[model samples]
Target chain A: MEITELRTPCLILDEKKFRDHCNWMKDKCKRLGVNLRPHLKTGKSREVALCQMISQEGPATVSTLLEAENFFSWGVRDLIYAVGISPSKFSRAAELIKKGCRLKVILDNVETAKALSNFCEKSHIEIPVLIEIDCDGHRSGVKPVSPDLIGIASALTDGAKLVGVLTHAGDSYGCVGSKACRKAAENERDSIVLAANRLKEAGFNIEIISVGSTPTATFAENWAGCTEVRCGVYCIGDLVMAGVGVYKLEDLALSLLVEVIGHQKEKGWVITDGGWMALSRDRGTASQAVDYGYGAVCDVNGKILDNLYVKLANQEHGVIVNRTGEAISPEDFPVGTKLRILPNHACAMAAQHHSYHVVNDGKVIAEWPRFCGW
Target chain B: MEITELRTPCLILDEKKFRDHCNWMKDKCKRLGVNLRPHLKTGKSREVALCQMISQEGPATVSTLLEAENFFSWGVRDLIYAVGISPSKFSRAAELIKKGCRLKVILDNVETAKALSNFCEKSHIEIPVLIEIDCDGHRSGVKPVSPDLIGIASALTDGAKLVGVLTHAGDSYGCVGSKACRKAAENERDSIVLAANRLKEAGFNIEIISVGSTPTATFAENWAGCTEVRCGVYCIGDLVMAGVGVYKLEDLALSLLVEVIGHQKEKGWVITDGGWMALSRDRGTASQAVDYGYGAVCDVNGKILDNLYVKLANQEHGVIVNRTGEAISPEDFPVGTKLRILPNHACAMAAQHHSYHVVNDGKVIAEWPRFCGW
Candidate 1:
């Protein structure tokens, strides 16, 4: 069925477009001679993960255990709990690891290491953990090149198996464009190598040195120090990617299908059914060179309407403003107008919806529900 | 159970605090001689609604028809759907009206008015409509003094019935303190009255002249022309309310319980399991008087420890910084230490959780699961 016949405020995924992205990224990994364990938290759909998991037992990264549980049940074997693991999460991780899930956890401190090790010992499980490195002081992880790096890594191993170091060049998101993103990638590769060498010198054998982030992974020129890449959003580019010249609007395969409900010609505002609830409240791209207020408003065929941008959105109502097109006259878009919205941040937006209305050749073909919560 | 023993990433609601907020607002309405139609979207729990409900049937403003339906199913009678009526939502509202829900919907333009009217006509439902007036320009609604508003209100009644005029001073969120919020309330009260007067002069009898926003309702002065007040956030005060000086951090009844995961004492950053994913991506009070990045980091007992705050939040990790603590460390917190995170915005944060963990006298008395999705 066409998107118009489905329902208002639905998530539409272009099947052909999605497959192309997955294949393209996989090919990139092949050419770079590295493994690609795509972060499944971006899609959160088993079907999307399977479509993208063209090789192996489907290596993936999970933001929540709920995702790990869902993906493994879907037959995905290799998985990394990307979020920093707490003592409270030890039992759950041990349960999964002992149950034969190739579950890897990340840690940056000694307290977590002791608790994790104690929990593993009590459960009679030896979980593999990657020491998270803070390439840049963006979010989580420890400084990879620091003098205390060996101590931190040793503490994290705490009787558990060591799987080298993993670093994400998340700061690449702030890069001006592709050229800058490449530099960020090299920085990430070097940081991991420096940390890995330090660990080996300190008498630790490391097996998996992983580095990933969409911008960095997409533009990496070196994979010498990295065994696996963990980029996620490349499968469905978003407005933030477009803002940083990472991808164009045409490359966005995921968008919210919304219906125009009303318009204010005098005020140049068109109200629609898809709001922050569908698109997400993440204004991640707002600080970029070009601010996509919420997302670029488009037509049913996923064609960008010249100057229409969703300026503001509440719970269930999105206020659309046409920067061009007859100055947003009421006549420009009447009732029952089906529109598509390119999300600012795909990861955040994708999490809000339960399922994606899978489309191929401009018509919906199937439903792929996503798992949420802890 | 002690806060730490209960659960991590849980929503804790204080019964005594919530009841005081509700009673105080109702008492204020009684003193001001105005009708209090609390918006149920904030809590979205029937139990919370019952606490806020003063009248026999309980008057309320709903953001969605589903909320209206749910509340009506639980015996609520007087309700106004405060959100702008979209063409897609017209049928549902019309159906509910036919099903004996004393529901009134809002509209800002003539085209949507006509569509809603047509739906009501086809469904043989007499829908009560209020013209949404934009008083603060924060979002939604027609300008209170716009010339075409009366005509739009008239059109909606052709197939249904015109209830009156409504305005929500969302700009009150920008108010620095209670005095400014009081002014916002007066502005909201005046805007609704002016719009009602305009409609009256156009040969219409206004049945409902309403205005609200927690800031305005709690601080409003004169409710002379306003037949009803619509406020939502007061029932569960948050960091936004704390920053607005409307409530202290202690008054914030709901918080996200998170476990300490990691730390960098050298950098004075402590990481917790609660992040933007669990807390929501809204930096609601960042621009207010006190700019707590994500939220105020409180001790397990809800005590704000000096200048500590959950500064930067990732998907599943929160960076807690003790602005001026001597040697503050998540290392000291250890892996099992539990903390409370007061959210920036109550509605958005509450929406992310599956349910509220109701705490009375420091005990989890019940679990009220919240329904989500569009």
Candidate 2:
């Protein structure tokens, strides 16, 4: 099927570009002498994950247990449920672990670690757990130098094994230039290494030390101490990655296939069916050097329409406007004119859809299914 | 099952509040002497629609074709695919019509109207279409007073039936007070009614003249000359509705059930599993009077946590902070402690989940399924 034949506001994955992104990340990790455990949180499809996998003895990271179950069903055994697990989800995680799915979980506090330990002991299941280390104090994680790290590690008793430490340089998203990105990468590596060294000093055999973010992974020149790097979103680059200088506009592998539905010519807007529901409400690049309003509007063939951005978005209506205050005539983009929209954050946009119309050379070569919900 | 036993980061529908909201809107519409065709775009669940329906034969408005199909399967025979329709979606809309569904599609331009006429002619199907009228120059639709309105109306020939006009006062969302909301509501009513009158003068028997928006429907004192009013978000209000004065904070029927996973004690931040993936990135209230960061933080039973808001969010992590810069001890919100988060935009937040756990009197009574996709 042709790309234009698919329903408007549906996610479109550029297959060739997606493969290129995966290969680039794999090659970058190989050059840095670190194993690449590509995060499945970004591309939650088995087809995308297979391209990212280094071998058939798969090791991948996921943000949700749903992703773990989905990928595990597709023969990817080694998986990490990267989010801090609550007691409520232990049974579901244990179920996957008991089925020979080497599922690993992460946590930052002692209270949850103790609860996980209790659950594991009761179920007679040993679950490999990683201590989430805070690299830049961006989101969730124990401070790299905090004493609570060891306390939480010690709390993992019975059937819970303290595998190693992992940290995501989420603050790397705030970095402006390549120099800042490199600095973030260094901080990300140093922080995780510091926590690992502390764990080693405490007599814990820390096997894995993972650290990564799309920006950090793309620019980091050093990965000396980290054993493995986990990165997502690079598999399908977005405008956020582009704003961070991690990817060029052309490197973006996903776009929403939409059509011009109407026009507000006086307001210099061309309304499309791709609204926040399609492009997502992620203004990841809003605070960046370039604010691609909702998204950077593109023509049908995926070429960026310079200066055209989705200035305003309703639930099912996206108003595309020229940034330079240029008026766009209604005739120029009449109703039924097909367009593609590059998203601000690929992860959020992709999550809105259940499947991707995988296009290669302007033709929809395959349909890749994506699962959602916790 | 108890509300506490449900999984984290899932949608929780307050059944009592939802039913109350529905009854309030029903009463309001009755007082105004206009039919209420509740828009199903916000609460996409058929269970919610059943509450909003005036009768067993529902005449609801849907934003997507998937919603139309899902609601149609549940015996909602009358539906309006409310967003401006393009030629690409004609076949799907036609399919629903052929299946004994009274599906009404909307469009605003002559180009699309001509295309729809051609499609109808080829398929030998008389599809009902409403001319979308622009009331406040917010998004899609032809200006109610424009000559193009007549041109677009004339284009709908050969198996395409002109079924009057409709307008959404999207700009009404920007109004601050009840007075402003009423004025916007007046404008919405005047514009669509004007368009309907013009179409009738042109010898077209216009029947269904419709106008609405959550804010407009809530505050409009007069509904004269309009046959029906449509609203969606009122069934499950959000921070935006509160910001617009359409709903009080207590009136919001939807809140996300999330667990406190970790925290940044020094920063007075309580981290949770409900990130943008759960709460959505719709910063609808960011420009409002009181900017609720991601959302207004609430207790387990849906009471707002004074001074607490989700200040920052990651994909699977939400960092909540006190607006007054007071440090909240980690013990106050220990790991595994559950909390509810009110959303900035209910439509965006509700779209993130597949189902809503219906709670009544502190107990989860049922699970209502919701469908998403184009």
Candidate 3:
């Protein structure tokens, strides 16, 4: 089936671009001499993960336990639930582990560590955990040099095992060029390595050191202490990634396919059935070098329309306008005209859809199902 | 089940508040003497719609054909798919109509009207349509005074029936208080009523004149010349609605219940597992009078935690900080503590979760399933 035959305002995944991105990340990991535990948070599809993972029965990174369960059911065994685990998640993690998932969890606090350890001990289940390190003061993680480093690890006494340290250069998204991204990468490496070294010196036998973010993973010149890198969004580049110089617009595998319903001619706006509901309200590029309002406009075959972008989006309406404030011809995008939108954030956009119409050579080859929620 | 025992970062619906909001809208529509065609785009659940809808059979408004189909399956026969109709949606709309759904579609262009007319004629299905009017120059719609109003109406020649006119005061969301809201409401009423009068003078029946939006519907002093008022979001008040002064914070029935996962002491940040993935990427309140960063922080008991909000949101992480920049006490919100976040837009936040945990008093009484995608 062709994508045009499918419903408008739906997710379209370009297979060629997706496979190329997967190979690019794999080659990058190989060149850095580090294991690739591809983060499945971006594309929560077993089919996508199969092409992204290092092996069939392999190491993968998941943000939610639901992703862990779904990927495990699809036969990718070695997994790490990358988000900091709360006590409420312990039972679900244990359930996955009980079902033969080589699953690992992470945390950055003593309370959670103690609770997880106690839950594991009581449930008679062993769960390996990584102590999250705050590299750039981004989001979750303990300070690399803080006293809590050893406290969190030592608190994992009974059934919870402390394996290593993990850090994400989330702030690398703010970096514009490769120079700044490389520096952020080095900081991510040094911070996690410092925490890992501290754990090693304390006789904890830190086995794995993980660090990544699409920008840093792409531009990093060094990965000395890192044994593995966890990166998502690399396999599905977006306008934000393009702004960060991680990849070009040609590398974006995901796009929202929409049909022109009408036009507000005097205002030079082309209204489409697709809105923020399908495109996502992620204005990640708003603070970047270039802001593609909601998303950059593209043709049905995925060629970027010169200066067209979704300037405003409501629940079910996207007002496409020219970036240079030039009036758009209504005849150019008449009713029933199919158009593609390159989202500001691929992860956020993909989450809005239940399935991806995998398009290959301008035709939909398959429908890959994806899931959301915890 | 107690909410404390449930998972974190999930949608919570206050049963009392939801019913109250539903009843409030019903009473308002009754006092105005107009049919309340509640828009199901906000709460896409059969159970929620059963309460908000005028009847189980419904005089409802939907944004997508999927919603029309879903509501029809749940016994809502009368629905107007409120978004402008694209030609691609004709077949699905026909199917719904064939299945005993009194489905009406809206459009603002001659191109769509012609295509829809041809498709309906070919399918031998008579689908009623409403000509959309640009009430506040906000989004899609033909200007109420535009000549294209009659031109598009005339283009609908065969099986597409011209019912009347519809308009939404989408810009009313920008209103800060009731005075501005009332003005926006009057403008909405005048625009649709004017378009309806024009259609009537042009030899059209113009039976169903519809106008609404939560803010406008709540403040409209007059519903003159309108047969029905279409409003959503009123049944699920959000920070955006609160900012518009349509309702107080206590009237908001929807929230994201999240668990405190960790903290950054010196930065005065309490991190939770709920981020944009749960709270949504909609900062709709940012442009309003009072900006609730991502969402206002609330305790598990549904009481607002004054001066606290989600300052930053990653995919699965929300950083809660004091609005006054005062350091937060980590002891006050220890790990595993449950907190609720009031979303900026009800429609965006509810789309993130697959189901709602319906709470009464303090315990979860029911799990209402919801759906997404088109």
Compare the candidates by lDDT and give the number of the best one. 3
Regions more than 4 Å wrong, model 1? A156-159, A263-266, A322-327, B55-57, B73-75, B324-327, B330-332
Query: Worst ten-residue run, lDDT, model 3 chain A?
Result: A1-10
Ten contiguous residues minimizing lDDT sum, candidate 2 chain A: A55-64
lDDT of 2 at B266: 78
Provide candidate 2's TM-score on chain A. Answer: 0.98
Candidate with more favorable, higher lDDT: 1 or 2:
2
Q: Clashing pairs in model 3? A: none
Model 3 earns a TM-score of 0.99
lDDT of 3 by residue, B1-374 (tens): 98888888899999999998899889988997999999999999999999998789999999988898888988999999999988878888898888899999999999899998899888888989999999888999999899999999999988899998999999998998999999998999889888998889999988899999998998888997999998889998999999889889888999999999999998989999998999989999889877898999999989999999999999999999998989998999999999999999999999999999999989999999999999
Sorted on TM-score, highest at the top, how do the candidates line up? 3, 2, 1
The global C-alpha lDDT for each of the candidates, from Candidate 1 onward, is: 0.82, 0.90, 0.92
What tens-digit string does per-residue lDDT give for candidate 3 at A197-308?
A: 9999999978899999999999988999899998999998999999999888888899999999889899999999889999999999999878899999999989999899
Cα-based RMSD of the predictions, in order? 2.4, 1.4, 1.1
| DockQ, each predicted model | 0.53, 0.82, 0.86
Which residue pairs clash within candidate 2?
none
